[model samples]
Target: MWEKTMPINEVRELRGKTNIFLGVGAIEKIFDIAKEIKEKGIDKVAIVTGKSSYVKCGAWHYIEKALKENHIEFVLYNKVTPNPLSTQVDGATKMARELGAKAVIGIGGGSPIDTAKSVAIMTLYPEYTTADLYEYNFIPTKSLPVIAINTTHGTGTEADRFAVVSVLEDGKEYKPAIAYDFSYPMYSIDDPKLMVSLPKSQTAYTSIDAINHVVEACTTAVTTPYAVMLAKETVRLMAKYLPNALENGEDLEARYYLTYASTIAGICFDNGMLHLTHALEHPLSAIKPDLAHGLGLAMLLPAVVRNIYSARPEVLADVLSPIVPELKGTKEEAEKAANGVREWLEKVGVKETLTDLGFKEEHIEKLVELVFTTPSLDLLLGCSPIPPTKELVEKVYRESL
Candidate 1:
């Protein structure tokens, strides 16, 4: 008898050291943010973003106007790409430091935001490379301020304390995620209006990423009731609104709910942490740097669900039933639940399997090896319901293919 609550129509300012401005017209808050940082004596900031989303999504205009009005100086680093690289982070850090930039503003999705976090930390220790930080070669305790301007409804890097970057070592790329207390942004903006311009493919991919976040968060070993509650709402919102947003790209109402779903999903993983899906997806994107993070996660999710269901059947069944109504909270329904998830992904236009995305049986072994060898990924596997064995890793990758 529980009915879903309607999305709020008005903009609201959420307060914290990491203040968030969300909803329609929330990007305008950049004016206030710019002024606040300027008053703190930070006159120069480095803007780290991809080549175009910041401008294409209509956030760059407001951000640029705000900085100009506040007389704040900013240097642009627009070379960040999907599956962001440590070399790019290092390049940006070098630019920011040389320009005397005191803070970093990350625009677009997780890639740029994560790059900004890495840049913020690396700016302080000019001696350390991003690989050093991601590999735990040094424990960093401080970073320049980071402001996240989220233009996509996925990769809640805006609200979490984690950043993922790929580093090249021994002629192979190793993508590792780093978490530090200072990785949290000092300010974030999540304006649904900015998301209205997202393309159909990205819309589908990003929402799938949000769903995967909640799915793994709810089933991780550290999951709590609070995380479970947020996870269920995230799934429900994505189920109801993602289709509407896909059908009509300009539907602000749908964008609002999906954006909220992505944000809370970020919080869920921030609190509950993540497991196999994220652990596995990182290696996929790391190996194929062109693969979209959300798409990779989508490809891996069904098999991961089947593998983890027995560990927390009742919880997973409840959280996932919004998308998979056939889930009956019984151990016997694991396969059914996972199949239902795959069906839902297909419904959302994410029909590519691992092999369809160019992975082969020969690649499975390397994928499994990366799962164990990638820094911090093994730690994520430790939080899984089952043992983190090479056999199990190969089985999941093979099944996904």
Candidate 2:
């Protein structure tokens, strides 16, 4: 097998796509930002967030204090849930519109931020419902400016133009929807101070989710030279710091590295696109909305890695070489890489199977059906290095169970 290395030209040519403000006290700076927006004729902004984490972490109070101190007018829609529902996005959009919000501010993890992305655009296109936001149904043409505050170290929703929302299509079936094109946050505040209060479980799960993002991106055939190099570093950082964060949630340095890793991996996967793991994980979380997105991905990634390694060991070796230096650039490195991932997942408390996450055997058929029928399937199969057949996807799901 050929050894892979980053080219100097690719490193020189790579550019930062998103504007990020990171460090302690970054949320306090939002006051000036709000004033800047108001000066631009955007009188009021809609703050979209989840119910608990921000409030529990003090980020919510910090944001409200900033807006109030700056005399910035805003409305709050804090009902966003995990695996945000289309109905929730619709309702939030309507609320933003009725409140005359000129922009959207998203706080919390990926779901609310993603909902804010949808709500910001939906506020602009009142004619387009969540249905039209579906990949096959709509092409987003316009969006309001969005500012993202990431309280969790996962999803990198703040760093990309893409957002994922779940919709109940055909009245009963749960499916994931994605929208892109200038829907990214105008700027992001990635303050590790905000993540200091994050629970150990969230730190573990979200960090693993970041790891999945890089692994999928680096292994895919369409991965760009710049993204591959970035993902390698992201994976290395995750391997080094995830356990540290989990062991001590207040380890600010570890938290910063994990948060930074999420941003790097998010950008990498945003460009390279994700494959079977994300493809299968979506239906599980979409069906069971209460399930955590990272947990679902965690349950599936090891199994997916094993499948990918079987078919394309070289790809696996390329991605895992940074984490498990024992890869040594050989086909045999695939099993070593896969084993390293499984062992790490266990160490990080991601040892759950689908059953452990409340999924049952009966759900497998429905999930397979959704995979084949949903719009996500096209993107999934297209990016997959191996030709993904129904039997293959189902087999992986069963094995994961």
Candidate 3:
């Protein structure tokens, strides 16, 4: 493991540029923010979101009312789905361009927010085809402004510069890739009221996903003290408030804390990055587009933690201490951490294994091949505490199964 203090210059290089508005009724202020955007010479805007969640939850109604009140001319691109495809991004960008939208407002969880980020930048480079956009070399110098509304407590995409989108390549296979800088949202809103109608299953999964972010980022080889602090605070909040939020979706205080933790964890992982678990899980979701990102994280996190334990016990102990009480008193740090995470997942009602989620034993070899071939493989290697081997990754997959 690369254990050394982060240089002051590196710490200073961290970038979290979103102007955040967090409170009980922050959604009500969207009208004023829209008015401000209009005042800034943006005559038209685009609202990117999932097909039904926002509408069913009434969050979309609120956003529409606010935009109408501000006379903010905008187009609606509500075709986004879970594990958002680059096709959806390109489609949204095409709509925004045709409507001449000067900005984009993402109104849901990470999928929509990330889609909006990609759309915002694509608007600036309309000459590039969808295939051209995925080339990474075609980086945009600027993007239309973006406003992120947190309708879910997971995916903290609202507060970070990075976006994850699935791109189809080499015929039919879809790969997950990272985009940054130009994709960051210009503003973020965290209104607890907006999350009151989120389903319990989603609530549990998203909370676990945030916890996964904190654990993976804080224990990685690239973490800094600042990153560790953010991760620690996130874990503390997850341990104390996640169950409350899961048990009673109407609990505004619990919802607020979880939302806060998700945002902080976003900033942490955006700087510290994530490891093998994310790399492994990304392909699962790309292959099974209907699977929620959080569900995959919950199923795989404990196994990934265990795989790295022998090489980084002390770090794992510190990482798991807040959430796993047994780890606070054990010399067996890695074992305790892995067991604790598995226990918590079951306690929170996320007991599904890879098989339960439709990963058959026959699919193991192909999954392993995809992981090794992934474009994000370098990131996975850099983030793992112990450098991963192909055989080790295959074992993790079988264990997850």
Best by TM-score: 1
As a whole number from 0 to 100, the lDDT of residue 243 in candidate 2 is 82
- Each model's lDDT comes to 0.90, 0.78, 0.79
Backbone clashes in model 1, listed as residue pairs: none
Candidate 1's TM-score? 0.97
Order the candidate numbers by lDDT, best to worst.
1, 3, 2
Writing each residue's lDDT as its tens digit, candidate 3 over 1-401 gives: 11124221121112358877777777766777877887898778999999988787667777888778777788999999988888888889989999889999998999999888888888888788554555465756788999998788878789887777877656545455665676678778888778888888999888888888877887788888877888888888888888888789898878877888898998888888888888888778878888888999888888887877766666567767766765543445666678888998898889999999889988888878878776655676677887678888888889898
RMSD in Å for model 1: 1.6
Please, what are the lDDT tens digits per residue for candidate 2 over residues 1-401? 11124221121111356677766556665776777877788778899999888788778887888788766788888898888878888889988999888889999989889989989888987877876776456677788899898899889888887788878756655556574768878778888778988888888878878888877887776878777887878877888888888888888777777877898888888888888888888888778877787888888877787777756665566667655666655655555666777777888787888988767789899898888777655686678877789988897789788
Poorly placed runs, candidate 3 (over 4 Å): 1-16, 135-137, 328-332
- Candidate 2 residues lying further than 4 Å off, grouped into runs, are 1-15, 310-312, 322-325
Residue 133 lDDT in model 2?
A: 77
CA RMSD, predictions in order: 1.6, 4.9, 6.0
Lowest lDDT sum, 10 consecutive residues, model 1, at 1-10
- Winner by lDDT between candidate 2 and candidate 1: 1
TM-score of each: 0.97, 0.92, 0.92
